[model samples]
Target: MKNIYELVTMFHDVHPFVPSLSQFAECVVAYIGVFVIKSVFKHLVCLECLESLYSYLTDIRNYSLIARKSNDGLLFPAKDVI
Candidate 1:
């Protein structure tokens, strides 16, 4: 929390408008996470398609895991259209 505050203060001049302090921390953390993800994706030309495929496969695996937890059909759906 303190680190977020320090970062926001340190980088305040970068943005034209300031968000309210209540939303500042959440916004900054989300912005940073997105920035990092974008930076990672930038290195690979076909990353977006691969990432989507990976995410869909993970969802299917998760569904199978859930189904195996019990005999009952808990029917977790796959992300078919990513």
Candidate 2:
């Protein structure tokens, strides 16, 4: 398995984790490939970026929780994971 800390560190340094408005605007422009998606593309891109950020944060949180429990010699129940 990959080192959880390494994964967390990598993601911590990534852009979307703490995005600026210009970065958000850039992402919107980057994802606007087709004419059909042009009108709502900015909103879609913003939402997608936020969703990705949320997903990554949740994964890190879950991994840290599991790691803490394991390090304390306790079992992390499957039911507690999302």
lDDT of each: 0.44, 0.40
Q: Write the per-residue lDDT of candidate 1 for residues 39-81, one digit (tens) a residue.
A: 5556767855536522323243334344345365222232432
User: Global CA lDDT of candidate 2, please?
Assistant: 0.40
Give the residue spans of candidate 2 off by over 4 A: 17-82
**What is candidate 2's TM-score against the reference?**
0.20
Deviation from native of the Cα of residue 37 in model 1, angstroms: 1.2
Q: On residues 23-44, what C-alpha lDDT tens digit does candidate 2 reach at each position?
A: 4453333223122233334556
Q: Quick one: best lDDT, which candidate?
A: 1
Clashes of each: 0, 0
Q: What TM-score does candidate 1 reach?
A: 0.26
Best model per TM-score? 1
